[model samples]
Target chain A: MMTIKEIRKRLDGGDISCRELTEAFLDAAKRDNPALNAYIRITEEEALRAADAADARRAKGEALSPLDGVPFILKDNINTKGITTTCASKMLANYVPIFDAFIWEKLRDSGAIMLGKGNMDEFAMGSTGETSYFGATSNPHNLDHVAGGSSSGPAAAVAGGLAVFGIGSDTGGSVRIPASFCGLVGLKPTYGAISRRGVIAYGSSLDQIGPIAVCAEDAALVFDAMCEKDPGDMTSVGSEPVTPKLTGSVAGKKIGMAREFFEVMSPPVREAIERAVKLFEKMGATIVPLEFPMLRYTLSTYYIIACAEAASNLGRFDGLRYGYRAESAADLDDFICRTRTEGFGKEVRRRILLGTYVLSAGYYDAYYNKAQLLRRAIKNEFSEMFKKCDLLLGPTVATTALQKGSGLTPVEMYQTDICTSSVNLAGLPAMSVPCGFDEKGLPIGLQLVGPHFGESEILSAALAFERETAGEFLKSSGMGVKL
Target chain B: MISLDELKKLANLAKLSLEGEDVDALAADITSILEFANTVSEAVVDLPKDEAAGAYNLREDVVAPSYPAEEILLNAAEKLDTYFVARKIGGTGA
Candidate 1:
């Protein structure tokens, strides 16, 4: 698989036409998608058309952005104009958006070719890709193992060389988890750093669209292109360009490690993270040991708040608007009831019910309100920790990719999100960079978390690690386009 | 544990109808999830005085041209010229 820089160099040198490059990717998708199930829909026509436009622009010597002519996949949750934006659910299976999502508009304006919509967990509700109505995305590394959710397809597609990079939304570990499992780089930018105008909301406060790429540098380029304030999404604060600041130097930097983050981690994951800490130390980074007791409460607080917001955000899926409508019903109320009951998957329904319970009159104070208060406590802890450390380092997940049909219960699945959810709760920037592999040869992700709007700092650190390691841990699945 | 009757009421509030075995399974799931969420109650922290105050800057209310009705209603299951076609109140047809 070629990096964006390699593709750009070839395009500039006239070694390859943009159309040919896009075709290569499209061909790869055709060959590999049957086994990987990476894409829910492949926009072959759109991709070729965009490739021609890119070639024409190059022919005319028009100014080009780094991502111009770059083919990438968008997670199914982000809307693309006139394209179906199913959140990997039956509810919106046939629903096409009339307008583009803000991030999609940004990418399209940059001349990024849309290959297709990547599969994901239904309504971005599950940690594993198995919950997707389209079906689970298989791990590119080992086909028997599952690709981590809910941005499973995006990560798989990128790892399988289906696209240069993929755009994914991370409410919890959706982006980073899969990237970790697939040996790729995934960034969940600070909340509100990117616009969410046309992103189908899961947890409005927690959800932020991010990049899944081969390396931190590629992730930085995509982030720079798509991060911008938009009137449509009032929460968007945009972001400063991080690519320019990626010095690949970690000298004199203080990296903090909280002891609590390791309690749930398996032995191999712990050793991998510890080795990464030693490598950073050798690169002149100071390791600061810290205790973050608040980690215990992040999972519960995150699930409560996320599900509560999800229940409210997903209320618009009634039969009257768009999406799947029941074939038969006795009355208006029955129509909506039947549609939702039939449309949503099991995991989505469970979350909606849980959210309904928390926000119900009597339980509001006990669950929703308590979670909010704990959210503040968690945020305050992050703020205090940032004062003493340049960045916090931890495991992206407690374990590697589980085999398909692991059949973990719902609560057990939610527990896997413990390492990644706190970043969203505090609206902090964080990323997963591949550090090493477990004994079973699955990738392990080392998480670099930064203060609010700290994308540059964390990205710089990631680039440094990538450079120092010479991408030794960034293994390829050897399945898709090898150009 | 959440009672089956309570789960039914919650499902009703969510506008979702659970039938037979699904009701039992969902009840167990929700109960376990709620139990997991109950861990938050044990957290001791200093509550902010302004808990309800949000920091977002509100955009000024401005009237703008809306999307074309046809385009907006493109994905609707059933639509008239400019409005969605839904079953009438107490109507029999789906």
Candidate 2:
């Protein structure tokens, strides 16, 4: 599980070949994916060929970028040209896009080898990996427990050493929750920091492609490779020229703590994040306790807005052009009806129906419009809070990884994302770095939230935290994280 | 509580179908979620007059090489020559 930086150094020093590294990771994926269900498809032929091409380029002293020869996994939701991008749903079970996502094109230019597409919650809609049509991704640390979703397999693959890092989408807590459960570093960069052109839309306004790696420094390396604007995505704001000063010193840095996030938090989880906050304080940082009244309603605001957008964005999948088509229908209406009803899973259908109800006449203002205004107020509150502090700290999730069959209702599962979703609502950057292990030996994560486009600042602070802790709890808890 | 009839209407709007007790179950689910979402109506806020941040980042109306028409039609279940084949919207040829 060498860092991408370490691997690059080795590649430069002639200690390893890109083809050899790709083969090794391919071997790991073969060994682990069957047990963990991490990868939906492993592109062995293309990846090894690309690896050889990379090696040849390096032999000619023409390395493309610093990330050249690095191997990583992509969440299945991202289009990879010829490879199938299923989004782990039956509807898209056969989808193979003709083009690559903006980030995929960027990573390709960097000469980063793709191992495979990681399994995820269907349509990136659920909290646990069980929602995947391919099957649930198991936590590498505990076989019986579930990996968090919708970026479940990406997190598990990184934590299981199947790839050097994983690229995943975080719409809501999809990326962070899995990273928290798997004890990996996952970043949800500021909205529009990375272009989202070829990503299969879930909640378009909230979705952003990001990196999940072993640590914040590794995540930072991948983040740099992905921060480019594309003409394809008009919303993508070109990454600001803010050189991340990784001072590793947080002296006098103001870290805000919103108590409402901890109100319903389990004791072990609360203790774990508070422990991280204390470590920051010990490093000469100042803790600024605060309250966000608007945040209490964010979970509701998220579902309303996210669902409304999903209902509209998903209308494109009616079996006319591509994706799953019903066997036979009397008319186009019946065709659309059968295609959607048969192709979608229970959760997807439920969301579509709820979204339809909210956006319907007479209910639009009461639900969708109100949610939008409340989202603005929440964003404004976060902006005002940033004026008082450099970063905000809290638990990544309210609890540790639940067992695979927790049987929680949809709202109950939605509650698990309460601490993480508000960041998405405000379009701010946030990272979930493993802080400590809960009593059950499950890992807990500390979520560090930053202002809009403050990726470098948050990464710098996260690096400081990772350096200070250095997985001290792993030794105490007897849980071996693949790193 | 949302009735099953309303659930059917929502499903119709979404272009999906819900039948039998599933509709009843969905009604309960949507109702409970709406109960939670409805609280946002109570939130106080002054709406902004001008919501747009600034000018749109409009790209030039340039015609680049698109996805080859053949490639685009490759996945269609039914196609008539270069066009995708579908049933007529309002008629079933009945």
- lDDT tens digits, residues A1-483, model 1? 678998898988899999999999999999999999999999999999999999999999883799999999999999888888899999999988898998898899999999999999999988778899999999999999998999999999999999999999999989999999999999999988899999999999899999999988899999999888887887878888888888888899999999899888999999999999999999999999888899999999999999999899988888898999988888988888888999999899889998999999999999988899999888889988988899999999999999998989999999879999999999999999999999988999999999988898999899989888997998988899977
Off by over 4 Å in 1: B52-54
Chain A TM-score of each candidate structure, as shown:
0.99, 0.97
Q: Indicate the docking level reached by candidate 2.
A: medium
Best by TM-score, which number? 1
**Candidate lDDT (C-alpha), each:** 0.91, 0.85
Where's the lowest-lDDT run of ten residues in candidate 1 chain A?
A230-239
Candidate 2 C-alpha error for residue A291, in Å: 0.9
Error of 1 at A274 (Å): 0.7
Quick one: RMSD of model 2? Answer: 2.2
What would the per-residue lDDT of candidate 2 be over residues A1-483, giving only the tens digit for each residue? Answer: 567778899899998899988898898788778888999999999999999999999999999987899999999999989898899999999988888898998899899999999999999999888899899999887878888988998888878778888999998989899999888889999998888999999888888888988877788878888888777887887685333556666788999999888897889988888788889999889999988998888999999988998999999999999999888777889889989988888888878877888899999988888888888888889988999999999889988888998898888888878988889988899999888887778888889999988888888888888788875633221222232
Give the top-scoring candidate (lDDT): 1
Clashes in model 1: which pairs?
none
